[model samples]
Target: MWKFSIRRILIMIPQIILLSILIFMMAKMMPGDALSGLIDPNIDPATIEERREALGLNDPWHIQYADWVGGAITGDLGQSFRFKMDVTDIVGQRIVNTFWLSLATLIFTYLIAIPLGITSGRYNDSWLDQSITGYTYLGFATPLFIFALVMLWIFGFHFGWFPTSGSVSPGLEPGTVDYVISKIYHLILPALSLALITTVNTVQYLRSEIIDTKQKDFIITARSKGASESRVYNSHILRNSLLPIAAFFGFEITGLIGGTIFVEQIFGYPGMGQLFLESIMIRDYTVVTAVVLLFGIASILGALLSDIILSLVDPRIRIK
Candidate 1:
């Protein structure tokens, strides 16, 4: 397991480099650079050129990429042209906010999904199973934006149970307990918006896996040996069913992170998703690249973690 983990980590290095290159190239292909935002009939051409030069935007693409890479190695992501602040600091704050949101969503998803899936699997073909299946299908079919809008209207605007926008209420002291509680309170709606869709996926996947695993020869043998239904499912079936699910958890997490972009925007939450959306509108190349690279890194890391989990859970994965 240790050897396999080490090998995966080493292999990820080049993959990460390639990912960064792709993101950088894509950012370069955007219609304009930071100077695009500065365009105005009144602004002097020479002034624009001078500012571009100062930003090294006048440099050849290779030189600019090299400089960006160097800065990145030292943990400097670059400067946000729009915010006029260190890209790291600006994005860092948003990352923290998104991290908390994502974490909460994940916890909520699993907490709800696990028991529901197990129950559905245990009672396959029953009304409860049918109802859960139907719900998940509708969830999977509906667009996230529409679901978010409906949820926002119902919970935020109608019931008035949660804040409609922002990470927290305005004017709360940053370090106080009330501040932390306010942050969580505001997050409930957005987090639910993210989690509900994912929960359906999780339940469906887990339930199907469990149902299939229960039909296996070993599971039948366990049941024939007079093991209680709970023991047969929990001690035998559940563990085996989890292997495939664990293998995909990394990509699952990456998808959730990506989903946050639109979900955060809908909720008006101050997370990486919102920051990225605003940056693109303003053509802040530095901020865009930084956020894209951050997402890529997160995806790679999630895959790595998933691989480690698979190795731990299923010895055959490590053996292979």
Candidate 2:
């Protein structure tokens, strides 16, 4: 297992490098540089050119890429043109916010999805199963941002049950219990929005897996062994059915980052998703590239995590 893990890590090194190069080139291809947003439109062309030179924006793309790569290796991600701060510091603050939201989303998704899936599969074609199927269909059909907006309107605006925007209520002491509660309170709507949509995939996958696994010869053999219905289903059927869901767990981790872009923007939540959209709007090249690269790395790591999970869940499946 350790050897497999080390090999995967080594393999990821080149993937990350290639992903970074693609991200950097794509950022460079944007219509304007960071200076475009910073410099005055009325400034003389010569002054604009000098500013570019000073900021090293006028250098050859390869040279600029080299400088960026060197700085990135040493933990310097360059400065944010929009925020006038180090990109690392700016991203660091927002990523913490995103992490909490993502964790909440993951918990909510599994808690709600797994039980529904199990029930639906066990009672296939019954009223309860039909109802769950209908709900999953609705969730899958609706766009995430639209669901977020609807949730924000109903729970946040109409009912006033939750706050509409931001990570916390203004003016609260940061370390107080109230502040922590407020943070979680503000998170509910957006996290639920993401989770509702995310749950569709898991429920459907798990339900299908359960249905298929139940018809297998092993399930019949378990029943013939005089096992109780509960034991047969729980130990044989449900355990085998979970393999696919376990494999999907890694992509769900990446989705916690990539999927939140629209939901965060709709809720005005302070997270990497919102920061990413804001940076792109203003052409903050450093932040944009950094965020994209982070997403890429998350995707790679998520794949590794998925493989590890599969190996752990099914002891017969060796990494080698």
- Most lDDT-accurate candidate: 2
Please report the TM-score between candidate 1 and the true structure.
0.94
Give lDDT tens digits, candidate 2, residues 89-197.
9989998888899999999999999999999999999999999999999998898888889999999999999998999999999999999999999988899889999
Once fitted onto the true fold, the runs of candidate 2 whose alpha carbons sit more than 4 angstroms away are 315-320
| Residue range 103-189, candidate 1, lDDT tens digits | 889888878888888888889999999999998999899888889999999999999998988998899999999999999998888
**Candidate number with greatest TM-score:** 2
lDDT of 1 at 231: 94
Scored by lDDT, model 1 comes in at 0.86
